[model samples]
Target: MTNLNPLVIAEIGKMANELIVTYGKYKETKEIEQTERIRIRATLLALTKKIEAETQTFQLFLEKRFEERHRLYDMAEDLMKHGMKEKDPDLINSAITLIKFTYCEDPLKGNSLLKITDTY
Candidate 1:
């Protein structure tokens, strides 16, 4: 059996730790690394779920807003037509403002899909 002096063993252990720290070297087991990887994956999954829920809610709100804007546009166009026929300057001006506020073009009908945000 080889015998190591107590002080020498302690110094060697300290030196080993120092070497590892300074060199940025680490040992990882497959199971331990997999556990950590799974934890990270679970965290990412949770965040993805939350983002998906938020996106769905935002989409609903967006659809409702789009519909409301279209309704406002229709009202503005009707007012403009009526006011033009009657020569009402104030009504015409108000109709123009409403049209400006609600005048978004229809979305492109092709395959120009909206982009999803990228995750690291």
Candidate 2:
């Protein structure tokens, strides 16, 4: 799922929408044969189902990624607290490094670690 591309999802959505519009036009005008209409409906249904599945997969991937990031942030926070309590420079440095890595990877997100790291 890591290789899943957002662009591909977007394109599938666009294609599904276009198919919906096309199906509507044909239904309104009754211009095409019934078999052709049926085929279009089937294609649209398949695409809609595919989009739904892909969307779910993407959502799960994001959730897992967020959980991993939160775990890292919590670990870093714990390390920082212990380091400060024990006056350990190495632990503090390691915590700062983790915070920087997290911030650098997802700069758009509001991270408490950013505030903590800025003081050091």
Candidate 3:
């Protein structure tokens, strides 16, 4: 129609959607197809959520790992400030061991492996 208000158009669209849902395909051959389409879209959305959650969990693991390294470095700096000239090799070795270790230590959390180099 001519110059319909946007709100009116939205309401009309909603009405059309309701009609389609209520009477469009229940008695026709398209019912199975429409249902399958909805099912597939739902499945895809679920999979996408799973992937996103996994990615976020992975990022949290990485952030925790970096925090761990920051703690270790801060420990070293504190030790140096106390007149120790060299970093204790044991601390560095511990960092290596921690990096290699994962969920074997945690009962509630599953650790994701993060690749950290020796530069820091």
Model 3: worst 10 consecutive residues (lDDT sum): 111-120
Residue pairs in collision within model 1: none
What's each prediction's TM-score? 0.57, 0.60, 0.45
Superposition error at 47 for model 1 (Å): 1.8
TM-score of 1: 0.57
**Strongest candidate by TM-score:** 2
Ranking by lDDT: 2, 1, 3
- Model 1 / residue 56 / CA error / Å: 0.6
**lDDT tens digits, residues 59-80, model 3?**
8777887677667556655644
- Give the number of the best model, judged by lDDT: 2
Off by over 4 Å in 2: 1-32, 106-120
Cα RMSDs of all predictions? 9.7, 24.3, 16.2
lDDT of 2 by residue, 12-116 (tens): 999999999999997967856777889889988987896698678667767877888899999999999999999999999999999999878963344332243
Clashing pairs in 2: none
Tens-place lDDT per residue, model 1, 75-94, is: 99999998999999999999
Which should have the higher TM-score, number 1 or number 3?
A: 1
